[model samples]
Target chain A: MNTVVRNEKYWLMAAGYIGAIFLWYASVKWLPISSFNRLPDPLSVIREWLSPDPSYGISIFTSDYYVHIWYSTYRAFTAFFLAVLLGVPLGIFMGWNAKFREFSGALVGLLRPIPPLAWVPLAILLFPGVEPAVIFVTFLVAFFATTMNTLVGVRSIDEDYFRAARCLGASRTDILRDVIVPGALPHIFTGLQIAMGAAWFSLVAGEMIAAQYGLGYVIWEAYNLIQYPTIVIGMATLGIVGFLSSAAIRWVGQRLMQWREESLGLGG
Target chain B: MEQVMKRDRGSNNSEGLAPRPEFGKLSIRNAGKTYDPQGSAVVAVHDCSIEIEAGDFVAIVGPSGCGKSTLMNVLAGFDNVTSGEVYLDDSLLASPRQAPSPGADRVVVFQNGALFPWKTVLENVTYGLLKTNAMSRASAEEKAKDFLSRCGGLDKVMRSYPAQLSSGMQRRVEIVRALVNEPRILLLDEPFRAMDTISKTTMHQHLLKMYSTCRRTIVFITHDLEEAIYLSDKVIVMTTRPGTVKLELTVPLPRPRTPEMTASVEYMDLKKEAIESVHEEAKKAFERGERELA
Candidate 1:
């Protein structure tokens, strides 16, 4: 019954978003505010997004919208998957093994601090093509986030869990599987969420610099053409795509860590 | 049913299939531990020696900071003694430089019952059996459920996680986990220290019941004199930091000890001896702390 009161806040959330869009509409179209007056109206942005305007840009009705969205999605997911494949195991090893930690820690520490954008020039020079270069930049961004987070996760598991496992007569393999993996899982999922966000952030930057087809490319093109409504459309599409991807990662994390969730008494 | 596990039989050693053998007779000879965290040495235990007969219940009582838990760690093979040796029957278990890894043969139940929070109560209980590969998965589950029921009031909580149960229930689950393995020696480091009065009494009763039925060798450490007197067959008192046994008292109180026996004169005399033995050492420790501060 108390959840009813707690849940009513969702209406206010909807109202707040709708109010902001309304304010954006009113300031530009009705109030004639100086800078915003010349800006694109919300209605025109929606109208342009739904129907064709070859002179202006492609809208939701055309295949161009999907092409850009799909392109961005593909690049982001591919980069993120590759980063996870390499980073999670590397991070776990770095945390668990002293010799491995000392050896790889130096390389990771030096490379992790360099901005993802700084890698762009080198990636472009090293890779065979621009697409590969962009993907590499995106992968680098996600990889650093994931590796550091996973390492922290592995390091943070309570020492008692390991001791408890040892007391149970668990072999080294058993301890790694039962104690270390499950103990580190909650942190790994947290890393995955952060990695997803970093992946999208880098994907846009990489695409803006060098990409044949993507939402970032579309946004840059619209800016060059002074297609203001189309620019807003590209941004809105990016926001939705990024949000959906992050939400998907969180969903998977929650499912995998349902044991934790259940123990914490957070109902599914 | 004797409420005890039988030794595994019909196994060939050449094929790497040795049936489990019964462990016995723990002996510690001049065991000591010292820590030097930042160059200065801090003695925790000094020349501690005790022999634990097979299946005997021994309780060690001392003031705080007396290295009781440290000694338990060395006994459980979680850490190596800085001096002397520990043995199980004829085999040397640990020495100054060598410590065996903690195994199913000796398990320690820590203060506050450190059962895995992520696991359900039954899962936690069955964990030891599964880890040692002592029983089939199906058999482990059945044994865990049976133990849970025999302990009483835990049948309904089998599916509940540690956080879902009270601390007392968690303690019970931890005990069940250790007992299911049929360990040779169970080292309980102040297991009842965190419980409330009602829960503590309940736990003591539960422990007494389990101890009588199973008759496994147990070493319990505590600060409570009355608790020590009530639960133990023999009580060993230790001096303050750099702890070594000061006195060993055998309780004449007979078995299936009840709440009523706690009021008996014998109980009071033993409690008095425990208090007297600890008082001098505790005062010395207090004065040393004061002098250091000054």
Candidate 2:
């Protein structure tokens, strides 16, 4: 009975997408607007996206499409990994130590307000290669996102937890290990999910300006060459891959924080 | 009587462990606590003195805002008193200028549950032993399992997270977690607050059973008059804000306390006296609250 209800919900959600595609097809074919005529229809875009021997250089069957995917995936993953490695500890230290919090809080306050893309010129100037420049820009946004969320995660813990831990004979290191870390895990995972999305967001912007490969560069290249359908294809690819990456992070979080799921009645 | 017999059956397995020595004698002398002393100082407790003998159960009751919890905090080493001193078995526990750091020797079961939500019941119970380096992991687990089973048959939920259990079960786990440490003094800050009457009554029985087996010194803070009279050896009533002991009633009732005793004539006399003393303070506190709001 539960599975039947879930299946119905899934089909209802799927219908939304189908309805969107149908609307796009109708807009281009039946609408009186000249702008709608200029836009590529959904069927033609799907055909071009699937074509083995396409008019444009990129398609699902071509090596170039996979190359673009690999490049974007590699950059986003690297940037996200670097952010988690540095940002988590930085956040923990800032929460645990007042002096460190004071020092880093000022630095973060100064830098976080500036947009990640705004660092493009400086990143390019600082690094000798375009790869480092784009990676550096993408890493900045992910780092701030992970660090700030992690810091908030640590702060959001109730003081009673600390009192209970102390009364249980936990030493300084014990409290940090058993109480602070586990207590803050839900927030840390929340930070990680946002960091993954931000990694993709800034990665694309950096690629549009600095990179020789990646979906962002492909979209820019397609636009310049007047391959309008390829633009839609590039966008769809970015959306699908970005969404999958975030879902992967969420899946990992659920496995690690099973207690949270159990509390919410979603786990055994 | 039935519940007491059932508890006796449950605790029969405790014969292997020797009875602990009665050693937690708490002494509080003219204790006073003030918050934000420099700016807008507010006195929470004043000239509050209490003497809790080893193996005795004492409950402190007062009106709301009467600083009962402040005294508990000072006793637990979570907060320092602004004046006077507190000692445990001749050792200075807290003074005007100094306060002992919270430790396993004085474990607290907070009003709201404080079990580590991430850890299982076994892990939570074994935490103090493992963290204090008092016992190895193997022995700690064995001891924890023993305590869990002895206290209301919590052994079945040993692997479950706190969120998976009922509120009553969570409170039971918290109590067992504190008891597993074998603290010199066990402090409870309204540990069973917000529980329904049925759960609270069951908890009272379980607590009595645990107390009989462990024989630890307990200082329970509560506003419930019946609870104070029902579970404790002595009940201390405090005046309103800047609280001080207004009355002390000793219970001459026998142990292995049954639920039926709550209706006895002797119990009613003690309850009436407690209500009369605490009622005046509650009225004062209500007026003070209104004045503050105004």
Candidate 3:
């Protein structure tokens, strides 16, 4: 009975999705073209997408597009990896040791609220060129949230776990590694997911400022030239990239926290 | 029945009848623990003192919020006492001891079992052996398997995680874990509270059997009088709130106590006494609270 209900729900979802796509195509066909006249028709776009002209669509993929994608991906990943390295330790330190929390906690609290985009001017002033700007913005976006979430995760661990570890003759370092790290993993992943999205958003805005290559730069350049298709493509690429990256992070999180799934009653 | 017979055969085959000191005597003198200094102090255990003899099965009974757990915490070296001290075998337990130095030889089984959720059943049992350099991994595995077998052997569930087991099964794992360690003092904090009556009775039997064989100084804490009466060699009844020892009643019942003994006249009388003492403690605790609020 439940399976039948679920089957019907899936069918309804498929129908709705198909209907929405058709409606979008029909609306685009009937709508009068204006400033956004370069808006490619759905069929034409699909045809162009399939049998693409190198000078038009495929050129975006070849020239500097790869480099731009690489640059953006690199910045996002570097910032994320660095955030994990720095944020997790700081979070653990703040969570485990009271004195460290008392000292560094207020500083984190003060800096956490300021948006990463707000750092663009500071990044420009501090360093030269696109790389520094992107890095700075990504770091700013990723660090605080990861650190705060990690702190919360560490703080919320069961006291019994700690006691059990201690009684088993676990060293302070062992407790941190074996008990605290695994205990805080779920929350840390949550922070990473949030930080990744923030970093992606910040990267786009950061790229708009002084980037020579990137999806953000492509969109900005296309907008200036009134080539709305390129702009739309850039927007679509960003959205797809963001969705895929978030999904990838969630996948990794699910694997890492598989043991916690039953306890949490998640993904039933 | 076959397993019990096998255990009997094994015991007969091994060292005859000399009792091994599973855990040594634990003495807590004037142990008092207070949380928060300036901020509305909550005194858990107030100048509480008790001596648990070697190989003695002891139960601490009290009303809810009676600081029974606090006393257990202090004894386990998990919490610091504001004043006073705890001594095991004449050595002071001021802080968590460094490895290789078996000061008190203690292991605690928590209310929730506190089994590492990440670890398998076998891994959890093998944890205590990991701390000591006394045994190799293979040897430890052998010893752990032996204990696991004795304590209703972990079947396919040996590889299973703690989250997979029933609450009773989890507690059994915890018991096996503690027993495998062969600690001098085994501290249990309402370990069987979550189990149903039948399971609880079965656990009590298993505990008595384990205790008789292991001969560890066991400190069982609970709010249940019947449980205390059934399992303990001596029962320590405690008052509530700023808790103190109310009375100590020794069970004259024979060792390897059975469930049938719970229905015995002496067992019933002891249960009555314990309940009455706890009721008085509960009344006084409430009156004290009312006075404080007033």
Q: Which one is best on DockQ?
A: 2
Q: Candidate 1 has which clashing residue pairs, if any? A: none
Tens digits of per-residue lDDT for model 1, B1-294: 111111111111213322223565789899889998899999999998888776667899988889998988887777888898899876888897787779888888988566877678888888899888758989999988888887766878999878887788888788878877888888888999977778888999898777765557789999888888888867999998899989988776666678899999878887887888889888988998899999
| Clashes per candidate (backbone, < 3 Å) | 0, 0, 1
Q: Candidate 1 at residue B99, lDDT?
A: 73
State model 1's lDDT.
0.83
Candidate 2, DockQ score (0 to 1)? 0.80
Q: How well is each residue in A81-185 modelled by candidate 1, as lDDT tens digits?
A: 999999999888888898999998999999999999999999999999998899999999889888988888889988767777788888888877777777788
Ten-residue region with minimum lDDT total, candidate 1 chain B? B1-10
The TM-score between candidate 1 and the true structure equals 0.91
Please give the interface root mean square deviation for model 2, in Å: 0.7
Runs in model 3 deviating more than 4 A are A1-13, A31-41, A54-64, A261-268, B1-23, B30-36, B39-47, B82-85, B94-104
Put down candidate 3 lDDT per residue, A1-268, tens digits, no spaces.
9899999999999999789767767667766766334466555544433443633443343555567677778888888888888988999899999999999989888888888878888888898776877888788869887999999999998998888877777778878887999889989999999989988888888888878778888788877875555665677678878888899989998887766775565645
User: What DockQ values do the models have?
Assistant: 0.46, 0.80, 0.44
Best by lDDT: 2
lDDT, residue B109, model 1: 90
Better of 2 and 3 by TM-score: 2
Better of 1 and 2 by lDDT: 2
